[model samples]
Target: MHSDRGGQYCGNVYRQLLHDHQTVRSQSRRGDCYDNAQAESLWSRLKTEVLEVRERPVFADLADAQRSVADYFDYYNHERRHSRIDYQTMYHSHQQLTTLSTLNCPA
Candidate 1:
């Protein structure tokens, strides 16, 4: 389900795209910003932790910045620990998924 309060979601083009995919679109009530807190919080953390102190980039520099951000994301997923996620990196979460699957499989 795609969740957003953007006006583009209400347009015929977007609705048509969803219909083609047989997807359901869920929208929060208008003027309600807190409904998308998870997404907004992520953006806030990304900006404050990764982008806010960085030097502004020119058009050509954008590619380099994007590459750096991608690299950071890899490190973030594999190295950084999160308190809310039991102090484990996102990589640990994937390991848990596979471990459970292996243990549950029939011999």
Candidate 2:
């Protein structure tokens, strides 16, 4: 996973976990603060579009919160148009990429 220079991510336990799972660890170069800009922007949009638009603005429980977030993600990938991807839904863009990759794959 990708993260900034944090003590929790640097510990031996976290490193061992990643190694055990064969997951590549990505970290920002020292003194580079904008590594998480994309993630931060996504979170800002989620908060604004999902949580802030709710009537109560709070979930009744953990399950409720999870379901709400899951629904939001479904809408985000399927229905929402993003300017970054030429105003196409994430799901559509993913489908196009998958099709292109499959066509380009060599036997």
Candidate 3:
């Protein structure tokens, strides 16, 4: 997984967790903040569109937060139309790309 060089990500416990899961850790080079801009933008949208939409703006627990985020991502990938991809949902665009790639591959 990719993340910034924050203390939490740099901690031994976090590194061990990634290692145990066999996930590679990728971090932006020092002094280069643009590397993570896309992820940061997604997080900004998630907080604004999901968390701030509620009056309380806080989840009851970890599971609730996870479920809410999962639901938002489901809507984002399958239901929401994005202008950047000719107004297609992300899932639709991804499927189209996958189909195109499969068709173009050599037999």
Write candidate 2's Cα lDDT for 1-107 as tens digits: 99888999999999999999999999988987788887777778899998888787489899999998899889888998999999999999999999999999998
Q: Pick the TM-score winner.
A: 3
List, residue by residue over 1-107, the lDDT tens digit for candidate 3: 99999999999999999999999999998999999986887788788998888877488889999999999989888998878889999999999999999999999
TM-score of each model, in listed order? 0.61, 0.71, 0.82
Between candidates 2 and 3, the TM-score winner: 3
Worst lDDT 10-window in candidate 3: 50-59
| Angstrom error at residue 74, model 1 | 0.8
Q: Return the number of clashes found in candidate 1.
A: 0
Please write out the lDDT profile of model 1 over residues 1-99, one tens digit for every residue. 647777798899999999999998898878887888866766676677777767665224768778867876787789878787799988998799889
lDDT of 2 at 61: 90
lDDT of 3 at 87: 100
Clashing pairs in 3: none
Evaluation by lDDT, superior candidate among 1 and 3: 3
lDDT (Cα atoms) of all candidates against the true structure: 0.79, 0.90, 0.91
* 10 residues in a row with least lDDT, candidate 1: 53-62
Worst 10 residues of 2 by lDDT: 33-42
lDDT of 3 at 58: 85
Candidate 3 lDDT score relative to the true structure: 0.91
RMSD of each: 4.2, 3.1, 2.0
